[model samples]
Target: MTKVRNVGGKITETTKGNDNSFAKENITYNSQKKISFTSDKGIKHGKPETLPPPELPSKCKVEFRPSKSWQGEFGFDWCRIGDSQLPVDKPYSDIVGKYGAIYATSPSAVFTIKPELYQRHLAEYEKFVLSAFGTYYVPNLSLMKGEIAVLDAAIEIKENPDSMYYKYDKTVFEVKILEKLSNTKGKHFNDKVLEIKCLKEFSSKQKIELIATKNKIDNKIGQINVLPNNKVKEIDILFIPVEHNGSSGTIKGKEITILTNALKQAYVKGNIVRHKEKIKVGGWWYDLFFTKKDDKGVVSMETSNIRSIHRALDDVFFKEKDNEIYKNHYRVYMLTNSTSLNGMAEDIGKNAKVVVVYNNRNDSTAPHELMHAMGLYHTFDNDGLFTYKFQNTDNIMDYTHQVGKDRFSTNTWQWKILN
Candidate 1:
């Protein structure tokens, strides 16, 4: 076992059984991006592998992939890569020492982190944090479900009083000190003063939680929770993104900024919609890039005719399905100009080319359209395979997002048919 302690601001790990030299290298792992090792001291990993395709019920379907972006000669470009993580409907260790340092060199390292899926990973959260808090959660409930962001995060520098932060997946400062690892749970969690720092202000936004606390807590911040275990099976999503038609260029500056934050916020809203039992639908990870480039085959068009949009996307996505993109990736688009349709994803569409969307749409656009591409018929549509008489209009499949209570959930009867 390796003991992790903070030597000043640097993280130091001391091991007992094998060679303890892996901790001495100058390695950097950003909480927002991913945990990686430099070539000098890390184990040699084969080329990254992606998650297998999802097997949807004969009645419904979904898949996984990641959006890998890099700078190219033509400004910015993107492609698909293997999704790094997925949500497991199980409990995790709360021991802070049971986190990242021990398996620092291993590829299967797991940390109970609080992750935020940042728009373009390196993008700071000053504006987004302020806006979202102002819009949805200023003086909100004291304790709520923490699984809104796409992935997890950890602050390597605990002492730096920065104005921004990467999203944390598991840690809970309750907006104050992280006492979970210092002592036992009873004493740490009982302090109401910590929880009341709820709306504490930072440079531009109110902090939801602090990264780590001082003293013997080891300065490590990660939390993992075992849920109410009502689940029997699991399905993983390798959520991938692809762009076409110079789609990212449609909006500039604030248009992009506001829309980008809205999409991320929408994604957080989408995360709340899940099948907690029998089937746990999860696709929590995504990537947004600083540069927006189109896929080679995606045609640039101006009009919003749904069929024309689908055709332009289908031809390129289908033609290059094997290499540049995959059938599992959910393709996203943006255009120089758009019309009445906020976004579009075809119904009961089997292939990847079957579903596509313009990202510059409203905040409520994604999960609904994504479900269509994933083989779910609208609840009100007569062609659905299962009979579902929803008692209310809060279903995600319906166009009821204006109320902000729509959920991507189904009735017990619908669950039975699909499960």
Candidate 2:
């Protein structure tokens, strides 16, 4: 025997076995394409159904508004039973999406008349939503947060004017590997390590010339105008320390200073500032400016750890926004540390421009993750896992050695979109 009941907006279905035992199941419905169901132990139970459930109306003109408990950042909820779903009976062509507007019926359930109709309608709907929200729509290019290794690597610098020399001295350039960092368990890889690898050596005269060129780069950074021209005033950052209970945050004053200075170095080194535009610290007259605490310790607050980092960010910073102060400015959430995740960002192109970094000493992580938030894709991603296209890792966007990070490639048009 099977029984169905509605608790909240979720539909609970139960089946009685021949032995009189019962099992409860949760069902998710998408009125357009399919139905998905899961069991109590967080296990998926069935495939999506192609047809709408008999309980759902075949067609309606009025939009299905969600109850207070159902409305969210995305849209109305279709799964819950309430007065919100009233005005349910109307002509088929009167709603916001006209012919087809797929809506969430429950937290996990969506409804639409036809999948094809929904898809066509969704594209236009997204444009409307974005236009209404005043979001900068970054097309095609997207990025996600990932981990990078900073192994103790070295490259030999020979005496000549043909290559890069060691920063310390031109005479003694040694190639060696030392300490290693990992983002995953047991498994470790040097393939994605970010370190300096010397190529050609420079003579004393060439070194002088290099210094001159660097000065010119600095001049350019100062002379750059605003966006579209590849230069911005500064990228503001709010560096708040999150503390829960008696556990103080791992970030310290010295560490924040180190990270800030490192980012300034990376901005010049990454050439994102020199090549594309001028990026500086929030208030430091460099690449970024940040918030600081008087005590040099994290601000401790008591909040539900229900969703942990994300929940904490929302509660503390209001909500992440783009250009919080000026153009090219953003916010970052810092946590104690994590083994699996060094940083994370949305997969879409520059949606929130928000970033999260741990209390690690890796300076490159800042520019790397910041670039990810800025909608820049890795130079070489999934080289082995997929069919290998770009195996080079010298660029900051690549997972290989951090040699060419200070230089931007010739053709990175995606960056122009953000500007």
lDDT of 1 at 92: 11
Q: Judged by lDDT, which candidate is best? A: 1
For model 2, how does the per-residue alpha-carbon lDDT over 214-268 read when each residue is reduced to its tens digit?
2223110000000111132245545444333323223333333333332332221
Q: Where is model 1 more than 4 Å wrong at Cα? A: 1-305, 317-325, 349-353, 385-392, 402-419
The C-alpha local distance difference test score for the whole of candidate 1 amounts to 0.30
Q: What are the C-alpha RMSDs, in order, of all predicted structures?
A: 23.4, 28.1
With candidate 1 superimposed using the best TM-score fit, by how many Å does residue 237's alpha carbon deviate from the native?
7.0
Q: What is the C-alpha lDDT profile of model 1 across 1-419, one tens digit per residue? A: 56665555656666676643233335455576567555467686464443322221121001111111110001110111112121111111111112333332234644342223212221211111221112111111111223221112211221322232223322332343222222222212121122221122122212342233333232213222211112222222222234332223132233322222222222211122111111111122011111222576433333334555455544544554353433344444433334335666754556433444444555435545655665556554445542122212333454444444323333222222222
